[model samples]
Target chain A: MDEKTRRQALKAATLGAAAALASPVAAQMGGSKAQPGGKQDPRSKYPKPPFKSQSQPWPGLASKMNPRPDHGDTSYVGSGRLTGRKALITGGDSGMGRAAAIAFAREGADVAINYLPEEEPDAREVVELIRQAGRKAVALPGDIRTAAFCKDLVAKALAGLGGLDILVCNAARQQSIPSILDVTDEEFDRTMKTNIYAPFWIIRAAVPHLDPGSAIIGTASEQAYNPDGDLYAYAQTKAATMNYVKSLAKQLGPKGIRVNGVAPGPIWTPLQVSGGASQGKLVTFGATAPLGRPGQPAELAGIYVRLAEDDGSYTTGNIYGAGGGQGQP
Target chain B: MRLPLRVLTAGGAALALVAPAFAQGPGSQRTREFVSASAQSDQFEIDEAVTALAQSENPDVRGFATRMIEDHRKTSQALADAVSRSKLAAPPPGIGGDQSMFLSALQSARGSEFDRLYARQQVLAHHAALVTVEVYAASGDDPNLRAVAADTSALIQSHSAMADQLAAKMEEGQARP
Candidate 1:
């Protein structure tokens, strides 16, 4: 499509998403109603596929996404599950990291979030949400693709939050290409640094400060188990993330620290619009899942909470899956 | 690691350890007691560490005192966070009556005497703290405060073990003379 036509199509899709937000189905199926004792049809709880095909520069902002993704700004309620704990979450400006930050704050943790400098706008929203939840919010913006920045990020979080007990290595880099031949050396290196090296550095820096009962959570993906041909580098890094979670759990468990990973299927976030998915794939995102929809970031907030809380004491070295019923587990 | 909130059943040893300081009571009263006691304990630890930093010349004693200040501050902040989350109100953290008495004794000590006293005091303080937190973690009314207790108990246990080591080493050093 031509540039002009593409822009118009983007505008049309945004309007459609806005219209769908107000539809009777969405109005009746309120997101907040899925409380502890409440029940609702899971399949229709959130938006479905045929999403708007949108594009943004690298490291997109969640605020720009059509039908803005929910990071538990309203739906999640905390009962002090993580009260007094301190956490450092990467990519916390959007996606699963944002969801976890909101939940952690509500659960009574002082939170420090790291994101790319471009995501300051989205990070601002998250900082506000955490403060509203009556918890400390520390925003550290830097590129995780560099080892120096990754190390500094952890240090700043430790200093800002005073100490670290929960570390969520949820930030990643994903850019879809038709073939391995199309993947440039720089692109491959960028993916490796962001997905793998960053976590390695951050965890190394953080493990020493984590006392007993500390938790380290890495965000794996469904792509790790079922790799997409185009996402070769990104998929392998997730596999590495899954592998390290098990390995580190064994290494840290004896020291009273728990390590776990979250494998999310097709979750709607800034990733889809910011070159993580091909434009062609964006419209039909999550369409192939059994639920026929993309899981919002809010849907998986509880999984992160469970992994970080003390109640999941015996649940280390495990991968918790949220794949919209596609059976990634 | 943190103990589960509801699943932890206190055994005979745990009850024996807690019996001297705490009396069996209703859940709400127990929670109130835990919160107030925790705040007081944390305050005492911080104040004691500050005094040690000023008085003690031995590297090990000063190092342990520095760690106590940092770790106790975190726990104190956690207690404050729990208090804000619950309906209960906590007084500003201050040393307990017994802690004040202990501090008075430690303040007058000099040189090696100060280090030995600090170690001994740490053993007593952390043992008491361990008992208080373990009891609350085993069965506390508020889920939030129970979590704080569970998390704090792990640190206190570590501190107690360290204190035991320090006290033994200090006594051995004094015996050498």
Candidate 2:
């Protein structure tokens, strides 16, 4: 058998054995299970790519995806890790931001989410989910490309949530181009502004309001380390994201505020279907990972939860990765 | 039940507010303890708010009491359903000892005094309740109970913020002509 098939069979055998044996070791493997002894293997947990060649406008909607990206809508069971915390998340309508938003609300936090106005349909779904979780949800729809709006976004979030303790700068712009020659200055500037500049502005405005125990999380990517030629501009911004996370963590460490980053690899998000990946690449997306599948946004929910949780007081200047056995490149 | 002992301050007679304690550390709360505490907390809020709805002339205090009743009832029912599903025995009947004492203190007051006391008690009660749910949600033994705790935490938080604002407004009114 080929490596992928063999691995799948091995995983299936292990799962079956665990079910039959009901061993303590098997029980221990049930990470994040709603109940004990309810283990599900990670490899087969979510949708794999061989995705349809789909496209959306500049920003995409999670609701419209063929295999809707899971944002822990039902699967994530939060323990009151973030009770009474207030959060501000960019791109909270979809992807990692959406997953974090859902998780935060479930963990007992009031959340303010920002997205493009076009993403209202998706943002509305998130708002409803947050409210259903019984937390306050503030929806702020606007472009992050402008420094003015980014500053306003934090101010609005503070006003809406009544305070701020968690800030997740997860919104990003990625458009894969075959060559640098085809990359326009406007596209580069857009990527830089959305990925780098916006965080700079948002964090600047938010830091003054953040108390000692507050946390700031940035969504970096695997492309930061192993630069994809097509994602030249995007990759560099991710690297910048990682760099800033480290730099700021030190700067903020003494004040007791934590700064961290999540570097996701080959996760199935709206970013992919919306010009973030070429059609050919989209079909085989995440196939290169050792797991032979793309990841769902839900998989990274715990990492974000941990980074923001009070228990992670000692964990700062860190970049937690969920790259599906691909490691840090 | 013993009322929170009222003491005369240098400026005026003030109700020495006795803050309710959850009696459990963070992440170590048991399922039974969680259910019992949650049910009691909800009952305390609902019962006190019911009293406030009748006694308070201030619209803000009355409105807040109305919301507390509506929201706490939902959380109370949700906790009961979760307990039923788990086949855990029902939590002890009625509110806790401390809650009963505070309720008595609230009952003895009159007019604007009652409104101020109600607002203050709600803030303290919700703060304590927030901790109880948070501790259980973080490290409770039962998954379903934890989920309930987590979900309820947000509402408790919102209520806490509202109570703070209401208390501040009341203070402002008292200070002004």
Candidate 3:
């Protein structure tokens, strides 16, 4: 339908869902009842905010998240794409990594998740989800920015899964500097090391054992293109990541390995709540994208699945832009 | 490629429609169908890729394919209701011809051969997808479809940039003794 009609239809559907949830009869029939301000209770079918601000730097695990970051668990379906494969994903405690991990497990791939030590609780929950999906899950706690840690991580994956088929260099750190002049050297270095250099280190360490047909997918960003003034350093790092993926793709192509990247626009993930931006700023996300709303994690899961499976066999050394049209180019 | 004249003319007309903010009437079902059909076509490409990756034996290809499937599926579903309302036919399958041959080669091969074939295809696919999204966005009648097309076009551009970088890197790697 046209934009206007589509919008109207979406609005109508949303209202219908809300109304269905609000009716007492519907509630009696197992539907959730709406609370004040059109909000659902925290325990309701629709997530309710436990606190006024659900955006914290460390929102912790999905289970513990107050209102919870929407990861689209109910909507995602696995088609056995990664059956019998094994993967290692950094920052798998929550957000995009966690969503990817869940989808991977559902697809029959065993997973090894690495998270910061402080994020143990969140890591545990993701591990449980993997196990529940009947897939093996190894939770490794360490800092990925260190080369030593990266090496150890590879060793652990080898020991845990016997072999690794996929390496998702997806962890990242972001802090808004408002302007180039305001960017501190420490901040710039930290962002670069976390978002760019860390991936480089991990890939280097993992390369030795990666067999032909193994894949490496990096999590870049929409900021790599249409960067905002405030995210100069973060954007620069993400842009560098895309180049890194490109270079890696070519260097590894000879070895029968494929390298790629995913540049997500404004998807509501833990990164948005805790990475460094204020909650107020994040609430306006997706407004600027053509879709006019922030994307949920569930929305991103399918793309991750597509890239990690053979469906994209003819795809490599490429970047898939999942942004809501914010950085189309 | 230069912008199509049709887009430029359509853009002018759209601009006229936008001036008064509410002057123009809502789009017709046919217009909506056209836009929806265009979006469905993009989704179908993604779905096809997902289906292929799910059954792939190569881990690298499989991993990348998995992500594409997950992301594109969500986007496809997000547009489903709208596309359904329009009742338009989906875009023709696979962009066809030599591109199909190249894709098949990558899927069936392994090792260095696979990589080379895949890299070449990445460039071609992104370029083609970019053109498709751009033209549809600029000239399509449905505002939402145009918006989605424009958004996807930007993404394809990023892919193109990434492809260029990959091509150069592959060239450099090949040059090494």
Query: Lowest lDDT 10-mer window, candidate 3 chain A?
Result: A41-50
lDDT of 2 at A298: 79
Interface RMSD of 2: 30.6
Candidate 2 wrong stretches, greater than 4 Å: A1-37, B1-177
**How would you order the candidates by TM-score, starting with the best?**
1, 2, 3
Docking class of 2: incorrect
Query: How do the residues B1-177 of candidate 1 rate in per-residue lDDT, one tens digit apiece?
Result: 887755455655576676553344334767878888898898778767776776577888988989998999999999889878885766533556677557645644556777898899999999999999999999888999999999999999999998999899889989995
Which residue pairs collide in model 2, if any? Answer: A80-B137
TM-score of chain A of each: 0.90, 0.89, 0.81
Worst lDDT 10-window in candidate 2 chain A: A27-36
lDDT of 2 by residue, B1-177 (tens): 644444335224332354344334333337777888998888778767766765577999989988998999999999999888777877754567677557645644555666777888988998999999999899888888889999999999999999999998888878888
Candidate 3 lDDT by residue in tens digits, B1-177: 889999999999988777673332346655644444445445434533443343234454455445555655655654554455544434322223343234323433334444444456666766766766787778877666666667667766765776566556556656789
List the global CA lDDT of all models. 0.81, 0.81, 0.64
Task: Point out the higher-scoring one by DockQ: 2 or 3.
Answer: 3
TM-score of the B chain in model 2? 0.82
* Fraction of native Cα contacts reproduced by each candidate: 0.00, 0.00, 0.00
